[model samples]
Target: MSASPAVKALGWRTPLLVIIAGCTIALLNFGVRSGFGLFLEPISIANGWGREVFAFGIAIQTVLWGFGQPFAGAIADRYGSARVLAVGALLYAAGVALTAYAATPLMLNLTLGVLLGMGLAGTSFTVALAAIARMVSPERRSWALGLGTAAGSMGQFLMVPLSQGFIAAWGWQFALLLLSLFALAIIPLSSALAGKAPEGTGPKQSMGEALKEAGNQKSYWLLISGFFVCGFHVSFIQTHLPAYIVDRGLDPQTGAWALALVGLANVVGSYTAGVLGGKRSKKYLLSFIYAARAVVIAVFVMMPMTQVSVLIFAFCMGLLWLSTVPLTSGLVAQIFGPRYMATLFGIVFFSHQVGGFLGVWLGGRLFDASGSYDVVWWISTGLAIFAAIVHWPIDERPLVRVAPAAVAAE
Candidate 1:
């Protein structure tokens, strides 16, 4: 699909601007969310609640984010991403601010779980990536997606430390308030993504048609299945890794640094994946990433517990973390075209968040029961292997409707 007339009117500079704005949104959205793990201990201790109470709130957030994504994406696909992002920003800020005052589990669930989740659905990767996909040319699309993902990584890296420092300097309540301000920044930035998807030279299909076509594709199902593993792995680590590290008799700062290291290393990993995805088989690349994740987990668990090893594990996992995002999103665009990229990818992301819910919730349950994260860690490793195998057979060819006439005929 071609970019909207208004987008084209701005000429070459438009693409660059869109990328910049998309990256900023991604950074703020992911950065703020990634640091939630840092708050788990403080919130639980303050409220005299069990870890499950806080974990369940985050779990609800993940599931609602998934459930809300398709609707948010559909709205963005029909209206404009700008509107979706603006609403998301408002809700996100409100949710974060209210979370600071939440004394009960139900309050936390409504504010952090439901409202924040819905806000994330509107403002995060699905919306931003789709907008960027439409703004750039086909050849550069993967790179653009990678840049956007890396920007999110940059946010995670920068924000994690900042979050910890905030909590240390002030209090968890003030830290949440400060982050709400960051969420509010998304409102003005959303303006940059205004307008509909760029029109394609070929006849456009309705959203229903796109949905039906994706439902019938084996590759799409495979992508959904594989992405679930990514969600599980990332959510579990992001929500529990800090505590897991602390449980191992290390300082809380060690966990923060580990997460920051993951973010830092992922910047390189995500960008490289984007660059490589353009030139290589994205499916194979995804397969390799999942496989490598299994290996990393295996090694980390086997080695002796030490600060050096933990940081190393974080760095290695970081390399594999979020590396799948650009490739997976690019695959959806490559197969279905960018016209319905957000909606299609949002459906895929829904599966990711399902895994996220289980990952985060289960970590808390298993830890509370067994007093260790070992079982969940093993489960993550196994899921990674399963994901690796599933991604192997996905068809990467463009859809028939998007194919050239001669190619379609052939």
Candidate 2:
């Protein structure tokens, strides 16, 4: 089919605007989630709760977010991303507000764990990425996705420290209230994705069919397993890395900067992965990325402690961090097509959350019991190697389906 004049006329402006909107939404969505780690020590100290209590809440939030992701993605796939994001913004705002008022662990868990997690599922990458993936052409899809994910990382980098400053200057509750207000900014950006899906392009199969299809695929299982490692590493690091640093006799600010640098470097890494993934073998690249992570973690653990060394480790690790997102999402698009992209990706994301729950919750449990995060770091390093191996054998190809229309059509 010939390109329409309108499609030709879109130039870079439309995609740029869409990408900007996607990045903005992602920044706000994941950024707040990333900052939740900062509240652990302060909140526990103030409320007279044990560290594990608040950690459990955040861990529950991670699992709930994963559980809610596919549903949110299905909603975005069926309805549109804007509606999902708009609703998510409100839900997120409410959750944060309620969390500020939480006096009991149950209240905290309900507000932060369930509400905020569900809110993020709606507004974060699952929705924003699916929206942008649909808007761009295949060749540019990875690039655009990388850009959006990078923006999310940038948000984490910029906002984590900002969150710390907020806590330092104003107290945790007031800081959360301010962050909640900042999250409201996503409402306006949500409009950019309204009515963006191409006409007549949607899920070819019902959710049941898609689930059955994915369930039967070996590659799908591999992808899910690999992604679970990604979640485990990320949640473990984000939730506990700062405290680990403090325990190591380093300043908490050092951990904060380590995270920020990871965010900053990921912007470059994610974008590069997207660009390179378009040209190279995405599965192979994903495998290599995971393998590299294992290597980096090993080196970091063995190296003597210094601020300079830690910063370098953070930068190298950051590059491999979210680089998986673009490749994984791109592979889903390649395998299943965009019609069921969001829903399929959401299922994969669910596995990731399961891992996230273990990572966050177990890290806390182990720390309280053993007085160390060493075992978790070793576990994370091992999982990275396993993830790399899992992706290596995945057949990156489309599934054959029985034609639904007419037999002769095939």
Candidate 3:
């Protein structure tokens, strides 16, 4: 088909097409990365390295991804998302493709760590949701964010099995090369998300002004702190859960299925959180999610390790997994407005990456030293409670940008 026909079908900037294309981008981007844990065992075994080697590489990728996203979001906010995503697609493909040949820890860190990290930063949820937030009206924004997040979760659910199959049918190296092809697909989908955020009628603000405005807001920092916990919880689980399962004497396939279950259940949780965010108090909802995660994690680690118990834990965890993303991002958009959603949310997301760095690195380091994930699980539980406490006091209402005189006239 000609470019014109496809563009016409996508309706270019139409809200529906934007949502559709954005979700697909999210799916492809998140799905491929979510499966990286599957390779941890095999890669370590093949290289005769410890778990820490692969874990550290992935931790680097996570931190780099976190570090790079803010700049990526700023560029998308100031210029447009398409160009950033296109470049990200190229980097992502190169990262995955080149990672196949990485025989040493240093090589893995560069290919899978730095390159993949930067690539993911460019093509990540920060950009996709920002584009969706700009394209749609406020009324639909939360739902759209939820849908996009759910699509990413769906990608995790679907891709884990496919990634496993890739490793099974071909070697892990070829499987990664196959995934690189999927990364390339993001280049085309990004076309629909082109164009800068529409500026509002308010006084023009430079990026510095925007950052300053957000910096002065206490709730913004609270969001940042809470999100850091989120990054910690998910990254630790995603990178280490499979190996954790194996260590616990379960089948390795059980770990993969558990991850798939988390993704599957998150679809419902994310969408529900999105729908509820449009109506309920977002801070309260956030408080509840973190608290609930604490309860879940506490119960999960304490429970026996069996296929049934693992699946049940996965399902429960899935419901809570990404439910936080839409709500947190929605809060950022709600408090600050959508014009700078990408940049502001990108900053909040950076905290998440910081947590991810600690989670992944700590998981490897602690386990290598102590031969247990018990301490990390306890740390995750404590952080969840801390996040719950911080979010409870956040000011969720929108800033009153209008003057008193103008407000009285209205």
* Top-lDDT candidate index: 1
In TM-score terms, which candidate is top?
Answer: 1
TM-scores of all predicted structures? 0.96, 0.94, 0.95
lDDT of each: 0.93, 0.85, 0.92
| TM-score attained by model 1 | 0.96
Predictions ranked by lDDT, top down? 1, 3, 2
Write model 2 residue lDDT over 1-410, tens digit each, in one string. 65554455545436668778888899888787778888888888889986678879988889998999999888888887888899889989889878989999999999989888888888878788988887778888888888888888988889889988898899899999989986788899898776534442443567678778888889989999999999998898888887777777888788888888888999899999999988999999999999999999888888877788889988999999899999998999888777768889998988988999999988998888888888988999999999999999988876666666755676
**Alpha carbon lDDT of residue 376, candidate 1?**
94
TM-score for candidate 2, residues paired by index: 0.94
Spell out the clash pairs found in candidate 2.
none
Instruction: List candidate 1 stretches off by more than 4 Å.
Output: 1-6, 10-13, 402-410
Compared with the true structure, the alpha-carbon lDDT of candidate 3 equals: 0.92
lDDT of 1 by residue, 38-86 (tens): 9999999999998999899999999999989999988888888999999
